[model samples]
Target: MPDTPLDLAHLRAFHAVVQAGGFSAAARRLHRTQSAVSHAVRKLETSAKVRLLDRRGREVRLTEAGRRLLSACDLAFATLDAAQEELGQERGRAEGRIRVGATVEFGCSVLMRHIQPFLAAHPGLEMDFHLGHDLLTPLLREEVDLAIDCHDHARADLERTPLFRESYMVACSPGYLASHAIREPEDLARCTVLSLDKAGAWWERFLARFPRTRRPAFGRVVAIDHIRALITAAASGMGVLLAPSYSLQEELARGELVPLFPSIRPHEDRFALYQKTARARLAKHRLLKAYLEALNPAELGA
Candidate 1:
């Protein structure tokens, strides 16, 4: 260790560099110049008397000391952020930002719908809503305060609150359904299937739910990377979609999309709100947790 104390600003710069992947990106994230960010990291290394990062042009790789220091920085920064939030809360406002991770479909539909009102009510509070298909990585890396996802693992480090079971249905525009004679599962082979993947994995799973001797193969799979885009394509009569019921509520209600084979429901996915066991007791997390738990299932349309 250095004889004198290391500057907190230098440490923060080092952490930001690793988090943002490069000096230039870190500078942008910290609202500082690239040279300034690089200088701070160099200062931090000089103070520690060890090289923390191995720089290669625009890329950077963390040395062993860098990895260790980054972990310490995460804990220290989180504690300070929590303290600041607590101080703000003590001043009688629901202040501080909540980082939320959610699946793209749910984030765009159900979660977004409910959280809007909550955020509107709490004028002082801010939120960072991150939507992705895989939320487990962000949760594990502590990039998110909490996550609403279909991850069902019973990990000791996590506290999970079961939200609801998500069901899927086959959807298409009414005109498309009428134009194409899709009376049975076999008829789906004749229709274009809108899928997130070109492999038509979702359609395969949905078809597996049916107790048929032979599964219908999707003739043409139109791969739309986003659920929202897939829904839009299905609404435009471009193809048939296999989507979660929660995401289809608005379109179904508006008669823009119609469900095919209402009797055949795909497997239900259990979505839960997950928080790190270490931060589960935080006041901001507790407030958001309670608000979500209090939501009506019928209102969510899941």
Candidate 2:
């Protein structure tokens, strides 16, 4: 549509510059000289007849026009990459690397347990598991092929499928239950609340089900950052813990931990599997997708 056709290489240089945050970094990533990368970006701006970037020393900020072009370039590059991967897969066996992003607890407790059989069934497939708290960023940046996120934010550019709902259970060790009375929801106020944070976020969600007037105040809060450590603390009769049911299956089954509220349903957090919309058509992606979709969290606990 324009008088001059924008060069793909130049556009790539501009994109890399923006992604890397500077010309020097972009040059290193593109395997080109800094001057060369700068020239390519300048050429791209000339072709478009607009200033796409605002350069201030080492820092570069994208202009309004650059933001629009970058979005288009991202889509074009992702589509092209997907097509290339699809073609490569067609010429080879069903084997490749799948970069997966997931939360720490879910990755350790749930995903790792399920991925064993999947890896065994497909020996040729390799899994690059990236465990973190913010998986959405890496997923959007294409650093990860897929992500399992618990966020409720809507992203039109992503393909989100409800993978599972992680339900919570209020539990404590048998000794603690015997020593302290937790007959009703209000009784929780008199007991120590075990959580990952002093704010008692986990217990807050469980208590949200009760009426505002009936909500119990915590007598003491013990914050343990790690899930396993928190579980161990709760198992030692330290305090009451509201944890995901899947993570507490063994303890509950072995009678190491006992449920507090049997009749009241605790909070359930919905987690969804996310992938870039039409990003990859590779067989590895499909295989992992099908395998993950078929898994039942309840069965995993068993």
Candidate 3:
């Protein structure tokens, strides 16, 4: 036998193929290209010195050697899951720390509601929440395990799981709109627009809709760094805001804020949960991913 070490990637790729019965199905499940999946499986067969799959037709059939290896893979993955569940941290309690970073709007509008249930279910787990608009700073500094950021950064060391997009519609207190005779996107030029000082992606997208409305007054820019304060200023009739629908649901429902043009959706900002690719493979990291996805299901298309 060759003295090459077994790669977990190859093992996982083989397992995915066996479970999926084909490279295409496994590729979809793993978020990998079909060729990549196939290459990994082929490499596994070579390194293990065994015929792992028989792909003579549309379906792939596991050989005897492949079946044995598949069983081992199943056992290994199961054991890892169990280890995280039972003996995870201190033999009883959840045994890991995960730092999460998110914009304040997500924390207030989406994440807060899900925290109680998640924490109660995983008592041994410890988490630190950092609120900021620049999701990159904490992630680059290794301060957070993962971040809900506005882009799926395509870097060699990072992995991204799409959560949602940052789409905004113009909104303001009903009283404010009633006070101003606003008819179209051009009306924003007169209103004091509240926006996060750190980022202007949402506002930029909204403004881009109107090619000629390129003045600072269109943004009339109140520029609050904190989401809560920004929203509060808008709620108090400070000015109009370009905000995600999720962040303004309660206000809209209560009639405190009304959408200017409900039909106009801003350009989509690709939002995703980002983490170190290798660390994302860990069971605990997978759990965190699941929790965040559950909280933001609508954005995740669930």
Candidate 4:
């Protein structure tokens, strides 16, 4: 004999009758007439070539075959329901991992300050902050979703957006300045200068651009490999630190460090967010930009 096809509708109606204990009750639950429900169960049993329900009892009871097949039907419908629930959880939100590459300074300042609000808003989102040296290398290699660092040339495949406005100023602890006279930028050459390891790219650029009139002809340089250590040294009166004004706001406010040549501000590029142009349209990238842009302009001076 040829095999009969199984219709899910017939199987569903049969399962409903078994679960509801009677054809009339199942019809009520399914919003169908009693005859329609009985026909569906009959079709299912005919296809299976077996008697499924013991209808002679006061309440219908499942046959042994019905009990076995009902287990299979329950498993199938349960799997479908679970898949739908998972899909619903993934819908309508930025739900994915963001691997961000940031310079040491940016990781401590802008990145740290902005991350909490975004995470609170998107419970399904995840992030990893790579604060290691030369983060731009990983960004260009596609290892990170975004890069946060000083403005620089990007390859044709990449795009950059400036995050804020920044400038460099000479600063030292109040105790150091009380004794040393730093009326001009050139005066820095006479004072001990603390800077990041290899003197960092920012300090190098600042020195090359400083005017012969205002800048030191030859400055005493102490290179620290860490930004936090550099900040600590400057606070301890180790030397004059040429640093971004915004990053030192807390120190300045608390009188831990004092700025010199307040009138002579050398503006510099703020940290920028960089990503491949191909990823510009992605929801995660757009969401990150939206949150970062909402930062307080007064505090960030963007």
Residue-by-residue lDDT tens digits, candidate 2, 100-145: 9998888888888778998998877788989987888777656688
Cα lDDT, all candidates: 0.84, 0.84, 0.75, 0.75
- Taking every candidate in turn, the Cα RMSD to the unseen true structure, in Å, is 3.2, 3.2, 12.8, 19.5
Measured against the true structure, the TM-scores of the candidates, in listed sequence, are: 0.84, 0.84, 0.63, 0.64
**Could you tell me which residue pairs clash in candidate 4?**
197-224
lDDT of 3 by residue, 1-302 (tens): 45687799999888877766678878987899999999998898878877889997668998999877876775586566556655565565566777889877776666666677777888777888987878875675455778887755788657888876666767889889989877777677777778876355548777566565453446467778776676678889998887777777778788888888766667777778998654566656787788767665453233
lDDT-wise, the better of 2 and 4 is 2
- The alpha-carbon deviation from the true structure for residue 279 of candidate 1, after best TM-score superposition, in angstroms, is 4.8
Estimate, for each residue in 1-302, the C-alpha lDDT of model 4 and write its tens digit: 78798789888898778766678877887899989988998998999999888887548888999988877776565455445545645786666678888877767766687689889998877988888768666774445778877758567667788776667777899998877776776677688878775443546646666665655654677888777788889999998887766678888889999987777666676667788665665666778877776665444566
Error of 1 at 269 (Å): 2.8
lDDT of 3: 0.75
Candidate 1 has an lDDT of 0.84
The best candidate in terms of lDDT: 1
Cα TM-score of candidate 1: 0.84
RMSD (CA, angstroms), candidate 1: 3.2
- Return the TM-score for candidate 3, rounded to 2 decimals: 0.63
The parts of candidate 2 lying over 4 Å away from their true place are 1-10, 16-43, 55-61, 120-124, 278-283, 299-302
